[model samples]
Target: MIDHGLQHPVMVELLKKALVDEALASAPTDRSSTDTRIALQTGLHRKDVRRLREEPVPEGVAAPMVPMAANVVARWISEPRFLKADKTPLPLARTPRLGHPGEPDFPTLVAEVSRDVGARAVLDELLRMGVVSVSAEGMVLLKDTAFVPQEGLGDSFHFLAENVGDHLAAAAFNLSPDRQGPPLLEQSAFSSELSADQAQELQRAARRLWADVLQQFLMSATVAEQRSSSDSGPKQRVRFGVYFHQAISTPSLPAEAAQPARRHKKKPTS
Candidate 1:
């Protein structure tokens, strides 16, 4: 068996980077002696081993509790989260065509389509992230009821990156029944429907949320890594705090009908 201990030092460092970010990241938590043994036995640079021993801890990435922390950070920085405003799953977006209502089994379908490796990983992530979660009956439930509409949590954020510029979409992947392993993953976002105002509102809401949270997120990544990680407990209290948007069929108000604006006028000699 290939003793992972003796793998490459750079490889070990990559794993360590993952562990610090909590971004589905990875790393070595073993002893330096064992690492050194593995290094020499495997002919990896002792310097690399040293780097692993002294790997700079990253922050705000939740905790290498997941995997691939670096990539997750990349995803987040490029697209924080693009919410959808539809209560329904993303595919029932029929415009003057066939009308149907259903979840469309996105999780399963995505799992199957990409052979359930990477995409399923994202699906599970959406669950763990509490964006979408598994219920008692093994059904997926939208965690945030008031997020207005359901945005494709993973898709849009990544899609925006893929479509507009020189993009290399991630490889397709799937998961096992137990849902373990590095995840065969593909991620992108899609929209169901959008009226002019709804679209505008989503944009505005996204903007506001981004403005409020982004600096904090970046700073968290930078600073949280420095302090002893004791903030998880407090952050848990913020559960259900994030919102994802989706489009819905809402009654549109005429442009004229709105909150009455108070008119200011020159008062007569009162």
Candidate 2:
């Protein structure tokens, strides 16, 4: 977290407020005032608790940030009318125009996903992020397989919150002792003694498997959405992801060896 630029003071305050909020939520109906309970549980001064409680909540607190540009890209890539024979997004005309019976141009896609936002504006944003590129013939081509924002820090942070936050929430729900239903799918495998070469091979294998599975899932979801009877019905969105990690550990190190290495003074050179 320090390497990520979240310094100690900022993290400390964030943690304190998070703990206080969780305590207040756990016992909402208790006779004690929320500020009092939060202060007691978090060991923060009552005055500080009051001040923190009154501060305006940060944007994108309760929900994940889904940028309009991302939505446009997802729909463009996933929707059947926007795809070609091989299931890849078709190169669209840079300017708006009527296409073949079912095929849609760039403007049509932008209109479908977000009518208020201009197609040119969305295209510019995508081009800036390297998600789309223009050809010499003035066609906008989808260059990215996913609608991940690659250029903006704010967008990156939002993606981090949406992806990692949901993963953690699922794990926490499964771990709760009082969980009523079957746990959401969460599983992992770990090994302590894999060589670097073996780890790289496993990483490549996992990437291939995940990519295949994700494509199938996206296609199924797109078909389902198209075939749904009620367009206005209540809807729920879900995100599933795959990750890989490999790290070295000094499990066999002696107690002294486990300690931080110290720099020793060099002997005087002759």
| lDDT tens digits, residue span 177-229, model 1 | 44555753344454555887877787777767754565355446545444646
Give the distance in Å from residue 59's predicted Cα in candidate 2 to where it truly belongs.
Answer: 3.0
Error of 2 at 192 (Å): 6.3
Per residue, candidate 2 scores C-alpha lDDT tens digits across 1-270 of: 766799989998898778767776777477765787778788999888998878888777322323878777777767777888877788898775534445568988888876888888888888877788999877898875677666776777778888888899899999999898999987887777889999889988987777557667777877787677478878777788877888885579898988999999999999
How well does candidate 1 match the true structure, expressed as C-alpha RMSD? 22.9
Ten contiguous residues minimizing lDDT sum, candidate 2: 59-68
Off by over 4 Å in 2: 24-33, 61-66, 97-102, 190-198, 223-235, 248-270
- In terms of lDDT, the poorest run of 10 residues in model 1 is 87-96
Clashes in predicted model 2 = 0
**How does candidate 1 fare on TM-score?**
0.21
- Give every collision pair in model 2: none
* Model 2 TM: 0.77
lDDT of each: 0.43, 0.78
